[model samples]
Target: MFEQGDWGSAADWAVAPVDHSRLKHPVQALTAMVLVARQENAAAAQKVFTAVCAYRMGIAEDFDRLGEQAADWLGVGAEMEVALVLGVSVGTARKLISVGVTLDTRLPLVKAAFVAGELDFSRVRTIVDAVDGVSEATVSAVEAAIVDAALQRPPRALANEIARLLIAANPDDAAESRKKREKHSRTVKITPDSHGMAALFATMTAAEGVVVSTRIDEMAATVCRRDPRTPATLRTDAFVALINCETHLACRCETADCPFAHLPAAEPATVHLHVHVDVETLLGFADNPANLEGHGPIDPDLARRFAQDATWQAIVEETRSRCPAKAHPAGFVPTATKLLPPPVPSGIGGAIADIKAAIDADPKVLDGEFPDGHGGLDEPPPGALSYRPRKEVKDKVYAKYSTCTFPNCYVPVRKCQFDHIEPFDHSDPERGGWTIESNGHPACPYHHQAKTDGIFRVVRMAGDAIVWVSRNGAVGITIPEELGGSHEPEARKPVKLTRPAPAEDPPDDAIYDPTWWEQHMQSGDRPPTLADMAQLTDRRLAVIYRELGTHYEEHLAILAARDRHMPPPY
Candidate 1:
C-alpha cells in the first residue's frame, strides 16, 4: 500500500513498524507508538493538511508578486481558497489556522496527545473547542484533566467533562456559557403543514427541556383524567395552559382551577451512587477533579456541600468481615464497601461488636484484598473448592490490574471478564485448577474470547503473573500493576543456573524409587525451600535417567519379539 500510494515523499512512509516488546514499559513505549501512528496516518492521508497550508502560502506569495497594491490581498485569497477546500466559513478557516499555530507553539499537553496518536486532528479540534474559554495558566491543568480521558472516552463525553471542569475551575465560565446559550435560545419558529396544521419549535438547555417535558407530562396525566382529550392532545394543551396561565381553547373540558393551567415546577431526584475522590480533594485542600455520573468534574467545594447537606450511606467493614450496605449505622461512619475500608477493632466490645466479629468469622466471607508487605493474607483451604470466585475475588483482580491483561490493550478491568488462568475441572479435582483468586484474572471480553478459543495460550507464571504466547510465536507478558503485591506478581530478574554438565554422564540401568520423591513433593507439609531443589538435582537426574533407560529397554524387547514372531505368524 505504501509503495502504491503517491504519498509525495518516501520519507513520509519511513515510520518504524510496531514492536509490542516496547509495550513492556507502557508509558515510554506509548511515545514511540505516537511517532509511528502519526506518520502512518499522515502518509495515508497524503499529508493534505500540510499541502493545503503550503497552497495557501503559495497563493499569498502570488499576491506578494503584484507589489504594494496587492498588499491588502496578501492573505485574503489564501483564506478563501482554504475555505473553499475545507467547506467551512472563512472565519472558521481562519480559526482552524490560528488553533493549529497555537497548538504548534503552546498547549504542550494537547500537542503531546496529538503526537501520541491519542488525539487525531478531529479530537484535537474538539478539545480546542472545549477549552475555548480557558486562560493560558489553566490550559495546562485543563489539558492534564482531559488528555487521558480523551484518549479513552468519546469526543462528546470528553467535551462534556472538559466543560464541567471549566465550570468548576471558574464559576464565571458557567455564566458565560449560559449567556452564550441564552443568546441563541428561545427563537421559536412556526411553519404551516400541508394539512393546515402548524408545528412550533424552540431550542433550550437539556435540563430546561427535561423539566418542561416532565412538568407537561405530569399536568397532562391529570388533565387526561378530568378531560376527554387524547394523551397527545392533553400534553399539547397542558404545555399551552402552563405558559398562558389559562386553559387552552383546544381543551374540550376543564376542572376547577384546571390542573394543567397551574402546573408546578419539576422536582429533582436525588441519587446515591458512588463518586470517587481522594481525601485532599474531598476536604477542599486541593483542586483535583471529582467525577460525577452525568456531569464530570464539578467543583470540590460544591461536592463537599452536597456531601454535608445530602444524606449519604456507607457500607461498614467489620473487624474481620465486610458488612452489608445499610444506611449510617450507630458509632460507625459510612464508607462504601466498594472502596478499601479502614481497619476496625480486632476485639469485640458490645453486642454490635460481637455480631461484627461473628460475621467476620464466617468462613464464607471472602478475603481478596492485595496482600501488604506481610504474608498473612487468607490462602485457599486444603480441599476441593468451587469453580467460581466470589464477587470479592473478581473485584480484587479488577482493582489490582486496573486495566485489561491483553497486550497493548488499555480496556478498564471493570469492563472485562474475570477469567481463570488455569482451566478449572470440577469433575477432576486433582488436575483441575481451583476457584481461587490466584488462578483468576481480568481480561477484556475480546481478549478473553481469543484466549478461550486458543488464539493465544495464557500461562500463569510465578507470583500470579501471566504470559500470553500466540500460535505464531508472538509473546506478551502482563505483570501486576505494581511489583511485590499479592504474591509479588512481578517479573523476577533473570538468574543463571549452574549445574553438572549433561554430557559428563548418562543415567545407568537402575530401578526407580517414588517413595522419597512423593514424600518430598506431594507431602502435605511446609513449602519446599530453595535448598531442597538445588540439593536434590543429583537424585532427580538419576530418576529422570532411570525412566529414560527403562523406556529404551522396553522398546527394544517389544521390537525383537515382533521381528521373531512376524515370519511364523505369516
Candidate 2:
C-alpha cells in the first residue's frame, strides 16, 4: 500500500515541478509546468494533479484570447454581418436571431468558458457582448430570455453545453421574445479597425439585410453533451467534442492534454445581407427577368460593394437621365438625390412618338388591332396607311429605353413606354420616318402623356442646357452638369418609304404575319400588372359576393311569403 508520506511527496512533486522560465508570466508558467508533471503523476497524487491541470487550462485560455486579439488587430477575425430586418414574419425573424446567437457563441471567449467549466447564461452574454457591432441591450434581452428558458427545466442543472447548443440550433420561442425586446434595443458597438468597420458598415448599409455565420457547425449536435449522464466526461461535452470530431477540419486543435486540446482557434463565419431581404419586395423591383441584374444569390459584402460601385451608378444615371419626375404619393416631388432612386422608368420622348404614330397610321390600331385600349384613336379609314401594331413599337421601346430613358427617371424598363420626339401626325416621313429608332425615346406613362399633350417641350437653349417648356410657357432650363459646354445637334436617321402596289382586296396573308406576333409577344414582356391582379381578384370576389347576395335574397323572399300568408293587422 502507498504510505501517506509517499502520497504527500507525490502530490508535492506534481505541484512543485513548475518551470517559471518557460512562460511569459510567473503564475501561468507555474500553472502549466505543474500540469505537465501532474499528467505523469500516480494515482496517489490525483487531487494535486487535478488542481494543476485546472490552473494550466485557465492559463491556456488566457493566452488563447490574447492570440485572438492579436489576430483581430492583424485583420484575421473571420467576419460576417448579421442584419435584423424590420418587417419579417415572426418565425423567420426568430430563425435569424437564432443564427446570430449561434454566431456570437463561436467566439474564443465562449469556447474557452466551456472548456474552463464556467459556461452559463452570464458567460454566453459576455460572449455576445464581445462582438463589435452587437448592441448590449439586444444581447442583454436575448440573454434574459435564454436564461429564463434554461432555468425552466431539469436540463438546466447540467453544464451550459446544452443551452449553448440550443442557442445555436433551437432558438424558437425564446428567440421570438428576444427579438421583440430587441425593437427597443437599437444600440450598436463600433470598432475602429478594418474587419470591425467592414463588417459593421456592410451590415448597416445593407440595412434591409445583415451578415451571419458562414461556419458550418457540423459537430454542434452530436458532440455537445450537456446532460447529467455525460457531465464528468469533458471529451463528450460539446465544446471539446466539436474539436474531436473532424467535422470542422479548419478549427481542429492538436494538443493532447489541454481542455481546448482539440478545439482549434479559427475564423468567424458569415452570410450575406441581400439573402434575407423580403422576397416580394425584392421581386417588386425586378421589372423584367432579364433586367434583374442584382437579383439571386450574393455575398453581403459583395452586394453592398455592387450597390456603391460605379457600374450600378452608371445604369441608374442612364435610366433617369432625361425624364421629368412626378409628385410622390404624398403629392411631393423629391429634390434630393441622396436616397436610392425607385425602380421606375423616365425617358418619355420615344413613348410619345409611339402613341402618336398609333393614332395617325391606324386610328384602329389603338382600339382594334392592339385592342388593349393602347392608344386613344378612332377607326381606320378606307386606304388609310395603318401603323405597325403596338407590340412592334413596344419591342423597340424596351431596347431603346433599357430602363427609364428620362434624365432622372431610373424606374425599371417594363414600367416605361415609347414616345415620339415630334408628334407622329406632324412627324415628316421624309425628314425622319416614324419607324426611325431615334425618332422615339422611352418614357414612363406619366411623362409620356404629359409630353404628348404638350404639357412639356424639349428644346435646346443657348448652351448645353436642355430647356423644358412648360404648358404655361414657363421655361425651366435643365443644365446637366455632365453635359456642360457642349451643344450637339440631334442626329436623325434618313428614312426610305417604298410605294405601295395597286391594292386589290388585301389578302389575310399580306397583314397577319406570324413572325411579327411572335416577335411582339416576346418583346412587350412586363411583369404582372395592377390590371392583371384586379382581374384575378375580381373573379374571386365575384363568386363570394354572388353567394352572399343570393343567400340574403332567399331569406328575404321566404320572410315575404310568410307575411303574405299571415292575417292582416288591424
Candidate 3:
C-alpha cells in the first residue's frame, strides 16, 4: 500500500496514507527490515573484528624482529594499546585478538559464516573455544560439520551439539577429556546471599554428592520434626550443625542407629522426595535421566540411588484454571487446590490464632474476595471513607504482573509495592483513582520512591495498559499478558496515496554471500566454482553468507566478478 503513494515530500507524505495490510504491508516489511538490519550490523562488526585479528597477527609475526629496544623507543605496545582502547584486562585483550587470528587462520567455514553475519561473535566464540587446542585434522572435520549447525543454533545449544560431535570423532580422547574434567573437584566455595547468609557449595564426584545431599535432607527433617521453619532453612542448619560438631544443639531425632539419636533427640521424622523415573531407567536397562522435583532431572543411576531410601508416592499433576481461584482470596488462610487427595502444604497453620484473627479483620482483607466490577475495583459505599483495595484485589494486581512494571526491572511482584498509576486523590478519594486492579501496578520499593519523588510518571491507559515514562524521557509500555495486542482488527483501514520515493540501500552493498573457501568447505565431494552460482545447490548456497566478517572493497571485487558471471538469488 505504501508503494501507491505520493509521499516524496514531508507534506505529501503526511497527506498520502497506507493500507495497514496485516498479511503483507507495514508489519511484514517492518519485520523484514529488522532482520536485514541485524544481519547487516553483524556483518559490519565482523569486518572490524577481522581487521583487529589481522593487526594482532602482524604484531606477533614481527614482534621479535622489531626487538625490545624498538618497542621501547617507539613508545608503544600493541598489547597495552588494545587493553586501554577496549577497556579489558591485558590477558582478555590478548585472547580477543588471538580468537580473530586463530579463526581466520584455521576454520575457513567458521570464518565465512562470521563474515556473512549469520553467526554473531558469541556463536563464533563457542566454535573457536570448542576447537581451540584440537589437532588441525580434528579442527577441519569439526568445522566442516559444525559451522552450518552452529549458525542455526544458539551458543549453548551449539556447544552441547559440538560435544556430541567431538565425542563421536574420537571416543578415546573423550574419555581422557572426562578424566581431566574430574580433576576439577576437591574444593568448596562460599558465595553471599540475601538475609545475612551465605551459600557454602562443594564440588565432588556425582555419587558422593548425591549421597551427601540426601543425608543432609534426612538429618534436616529429623531435626525440624516439629519446628515451623521452612524445609530449606532446616536443611542448611542441619548441615552446619553436623559439620561444626554441634548436632546436639540443633538435632532432636532419637531412634536406633540414628546418627544423633541419643543426643537431645526426639521422634524420628519421615522424609519425602519426589523422583520421576521411567521403567527402563529404574531397571538399569537405559540411560534416560530422571526428574527430581524442586531440582532439574538427574542422572538415571543417581535417581535410582535416591529412590532406595525414599518411599514412592505416585503424584498425578493437576492442571486447573489460569485463575489462581483459591490461592489467595479475601480470607486470611488460602484453601488448598482441590486436587484428589489434596496436597495441603505445611507451616501456614502454625501461626498464632490472634495473628490470623487480626489479618482476617484487617481493612484490606475485610473488602471481601469478589470484585464489585468485572475483577476491577469498586467505588467505596457512600458511608465508607477508606479506599484501600481488598486482599483479593491487591493479590490479583500483583500476580497479574509478576515483575515490576518498570521496563527491564526484574524485582518480583511479591517484593513490590502497589502504586496508583494516577496518584490517588486523598482529599476527594473517589475523584482520585480508586485503589483497584485497573488503577494499580506493581513497582519495586525503589521505583515506588522514584514515582513519589517525580522521577517516574505512569499513565494507565484503556484496559490497564501501563505507560511508564522514565526520568530520561524513555517510554515503556506494559500490556497485561492476556490482553496483548495480538487480536486482529475487525476491518482494514483503507488509505489514499501517490507515488513515494524509494529508500536508498546502505552505502555499502549488503552481503550474505559465500566465497570460494565457503563453497569448497560446504559442498562435500562436489564443489561449485565462482562461475557456477546458478548451479549451486540450496544446501551449498544456504551456508554462503554476505556482508560479514571479511567484507570490504577487496571482497566487493570478488562478489562483483561472481555476480557478473552468473547471478545467484540472495
Candidate 4:
C-alpha cells in the first residue's frame, strides 16, 4: 500500500515519485502507473489554473491606474501573451482564463478536490460549464449534489449527472438556456485533417439530422448490386452529390449494362476547388503529391480525379533574357523588342501564352480595364496606383503561397487579406513600400491586427520565408508552400535486404534434422510445424515455426484464381 503525503503546494504533489517495484505482477504494475499518472495530471492542472488566476490578478492590479479603454487593450494583450507562451490559439487562451477565474471564485470545494488529485480536468470543466449562467445559489446547490459522482464517474457520465442536477435545481433557467443555444449556435464547419482529408461538423435540430441521414442511406441503396463501393462509402458519395445539387449518385461499375448508365451527366457544381500539381504528375509520368488548397497533400490519383471535372489554367513562371540584342541585317531595321511584351516560354507555356497573346491582340479583351496595355503580368496596371496591389500582383502572390504567412496559421490564402510587407506611406509613395509581389503576403485578420498593433514583428527572409518575432523575444519561421515546389513528393528508392549466410549444420543427435532445417531457414521459408516434426524424435523444432502454412496456401489460391480470371477470395 502507498500513502500520499500532504504537500504544501500542487507542484510538490505533481513531482512526487511513485514506486513501481512494489507491484509484483505486470498488470498490477501497469495499473498502478496509470493511477499515479492520473494523480500527477490532476495536480498539474491545479497548478496551471493557479498560475492563470495569479496572472489575471497581476494584470488587473498593473492596469488599475489606466483608463477603461487602455485596460481593455491590456487585457487583450495579456491573452496574446499567454497564447504565445502556451503555444495555443488566442481563443483557447481566453477560454482557459475564464475557466480558471470561475474555478477560483465560485467552486472552492471543487477546486480543493482538484488540487488534492481527487478529480481530473475534464470533470472539473464539465461542472464549471454546467453551472454557468445559473444563479449563485443554484450553482452552490448543483455543485454540492454532483461533486461526489463527478469524482467516481467518467467525464461523460459526470456530465449527464451535472445536467440532471442543474435541471432539477432550475428547470426554467435550463430550458431557456437550451432554447437560446439551439437558436443562436447552429453552425456548419469543415476541419482539415492529415493527408488532405477533412471532417464536417454540423449543429442542427435532431429531426433535421435524422432526415438527412435517412436520405443519404436511401440514395446510397439506389446503386446496382455490381457497384464496388461499400455502403458507408456510397453514403458519403451520395451526401457529397446531394450537396453539389446533382440529381443522382451514378453507379461506379464499368460494365456497359449498368442500370444507371443511361442517366444524363450531372452539371458541374458552382463550387471552386483549387489544386496545385506538377506537370509530370498531371501527365501521369510521376507520382508526386498534389496540394488541395485549404487542405494538405493528397495523392496524385485523387488530383487527377478532380481534374476530370475542373477547368484547366496554366501557371507560367516568368524568365528574363540574359543575351544582348543582335544587329539586324544591313538596311533591315528590327522592331523594338521592349515595346512588345516579353515572350512566354515554349511548349505548354507557349500554348497558354498564345491564348494570352491572342487575347492581348483583341481590343475587346482589354476593354475598359486596361485601355493601354496596363494588365500585363510584369508591370502594375493603370488606375491602380493606390496602396492596393493590382489583380496580376495578387494572383502571383496567391500562387506563391497556399495559406497565411503567419507562423502555424493555416487560413487559406483565398480567405486571407493581402498585407503589404513594408508599411505603405500615404504622404510620400516613392519613399514607402510599393505594391508588388515581392512586398506582399497574405495574413489572417487576427495576426494582421496583432502585427499592426505592434504586438509582433514580421520580416521576409530570402526565398520568401517569413520570420516572426514577438515582443517577448519568441521567434518562429514560416516557409512558403511554393505552389508546386515544396509539396512535391521525393522519389523513393528501392529497399535491398541483406541476409547473412546460415551457420554450419548442427551435430548429429540434435533434436532437428540438420538438412531439413537448413533448407527451410536458408531459403527464407517458414520452419516445419509441430505435426510435421512428429515423425522425428526431436520436439525442439516446434519453437522455430510461425504457422505460415495458411498464409502460403492463401497466396497460392489467389494466384490460381487470377489465372482462371476469377475474383480472389476474401
Q: Pick the candidate with the highest TM-score.
A: 4
User: Which residue runs of candidate 4 sit more than 4 Å off their true CA positions?
Assistant: 1-24, 43-66, 70-74, 221-228, 246-248, 251-270, 317-385, 482-570
Q: Rate the local accuracy (lDDT) of all candidates.
A: 0.51, 0.35, 0.52, 0.60
Each prediction's TM-score against the native?
0.28, 0.20, 0.31, 0.63
Could you tell me which residue pairs clash in candidate 1?
A: none
Roughly what TM-score does model 2 have, to 2 decimal places? 0.20
What digit string (tens of lDDT, one per residue) describes model 4 on residues 208-244? 8899999888878767889999887898999998898
TM-score order of candidates, best first? 4, 3, 1, 2
Which structure is stronger by TM-score: 2 or 4? Answer: 4
Off by over 4 Å in 3: 1-30, 33-37, 40-51, 54-80, 175-570
lDDT of 2 by residue, 43-102 (tens): 222322243343344335434655554332221111100011122222333333433345
Residue-wise C-alpha lDDT for candidate 3, range 380-434, written one tens digit per residue: 5332234566666675566445466765455656678878766667897666656
Cand. 4 Cα-lDDT? 0.60
Instruction: Report the C-alpha lDDT of model 1 over 386-464, residue by residue, as the tens digit.
Output: 6666776565555445456654455656578878666666686445655555567788776686566454556554344
Model 2 segments more than 4 A misplaced: 1-389, 420-439, 458-468, 472-487, 490-494, 499-570
Best by lDDT: 4
Model 2 CA RMSD to the hidden true structure, in angstroms: 31.0
> Count of backbone clashes for each model?
0, 38, 14, 0
